[model samples]
Target: MAAQFDKIAIWLVAFIPMPVAQGLGDCFHGDDRDFSSAPDEQRFRVRSDIVVSGFLAGDPQETDFHQCGETVKLDCATGEVLARETAGTDGMSFHHFNVGNTFPDPEGGVVDNPNEFCVNFLYDGAATNPLGPPGSPDVDMNVFFTIDPIGRMLSFRGATNAFPDYEAYASVEDGPPVVLFQQKHTLDPINGLPGGADQGVSATVAI
Candidate 1:
């Protein structure tokens, strides 16, 4: 999937509550769901640090079915994810992605901020969705993570160009938390027709 796109920019964003997929069962049920009591157990409830907003990526979006949504495996002691040649990626190193180049480096054309991290998904690109037709234009999305000096907040939004016929969903992590990310667009632009329309929402929540 990464091979098709020259680059993918990713970032952290907010979420809203959603319904569970049919037959998902109790696999995602957290033990200490009550907020007034155990809070640590709820940390796992985030399900994913990375939320995909496009058609979709790979299959098995769930975390081994043990947890809902997808998670980037962390090296627990160091809190770093490995850059390697993984399956379904066709062997591209995460370290080699063309990322963060578009970010503004100088303040008043002078200095660097040095605090921003990689929003790892594509800010502008049409990705290949697994469910899309063979060699087809699958997903179009954009994510800007505090690039502007005035606003240092995460922003994830997109106008997906695809032919799914059904509405385009902000391809979120598989088996997400109680909430899900979604966006709606008209059938014209994506389907090569007329009368374009797009709809989306964002929220800032305190944990």
Candidate 2:
């Protein structure tokens, strides 16, 4: 697979109140499981976001690569984003495939709340998609996230592909996404698409 253009920015967002950032939505309102006597719906503000992307050449695919698009998270209080990437990680390769890295993706989440929200993102090893099991197709380290933050965040429980919690900007009255209910099954813990760009690795007009 060859490389695409410099940067391909894509936003898959569905706001309840409406747009964010440039006059972003004030908050999101909705019902809850306890409709019998539920209180008034709380407003959720855009608390944070995770922007996963790759530059033209020299894409980031290593541990603590700031521009790898997995280093920062939005910080609503101080009006800034928090650092999500941790330096000095013990990342290792499994059969040429790297693993053990954390990447936060809030905007990728569809299930939001005024109090609680699940963080969605990938662990990183998937990005260094090395050759798989002898006969597997050729893999690229900097090309495993063509649909990242769009894939699915791995959780212990949950069913259906929910949005990335890292992508959601909706939060409640200066509070985090509220907890509508607690889901115990099929939680989204896995987050990663099949491909991306960047890293120390580069091909001669190839991925």
Candidate 3:
């Protein structure tokens, strides 16, 4: 069954608490499109130093809650998660999230924060779900980060497969603790629609 955009918006504004897709779409549509003036693969380099991190959190709207309510066993060391619960008839489930451990950096190490780690799951070009097509049950995971002026970790959020699994998005080597992983938009591309331009990425860091 295909998930409708309106239903997803309801879940985002009412049920689920996190950054909603509609808001993101709005932000991207208003930002500048061409990062560099040069056409075709133009590079826009901005020199800046900051620490960043985050994780994934959320299930498809079409997921089956009944089947997802069960507990799924998994290894704590690696990020690999094995299903301990069955997917509901809708083929979707919600998972809880947590932060990862902290890592040690040099006195003044520069951590590059990409404007956005954009993932494009174009459903229009194919006959299946763009993020995780049919036969691929794994949820589409991601990490979003925000850093403070002093380069301290400010906030982090992302997705996971299990409801209560805290180790789903942590780094193998110890890193900083993450905040909450709430439901969010997996993949959306702005196409200069009537209301606004196609949704994209834009970020600003405070010094």
lDDT winner among the candidates?
1
lDDT of 1 by residue, 1-207 (tens): 121211122221211122211111111111222121111232221111232222123211111111222223334345454322211222111121122324442223422322333232323322232222245333333332222111222343334322111111121223222222333223432253122213333432111
TM-score of each: 0.28, 0.19, 0.19
Ordered from best to worst lDDT, the candidate numbers read 1, 3, 2
- Candidate 2 overall lDDT versus native: 0.22
**How close to the true structure is residue 200 of candidate 1, measured as C-alpha lDDT?**
39
- Evaluated at residue 158, the lDDT of candidate 3 is 37
Model 2: residues with Cα > 4 Å off, grouped in runs: 8-48, 61-207
Using TM-score as the measure, the top candidate is: 1
The deviation in Å at residue 178 for candidate 3 is 7.0
RMSD of 2: 20.5
Candidate 1: count of backbone clashes, pairs at least 3 residues apart or interchain: 13
Error of 1 at 155 (Å): 4.6
Prediction RMSDs, each to the true structure: 16.8, 20.5, 21.3
What lDDT does candidate 1 reach at residue 49? 28
State each candidate's clash count.
13, 55, 19
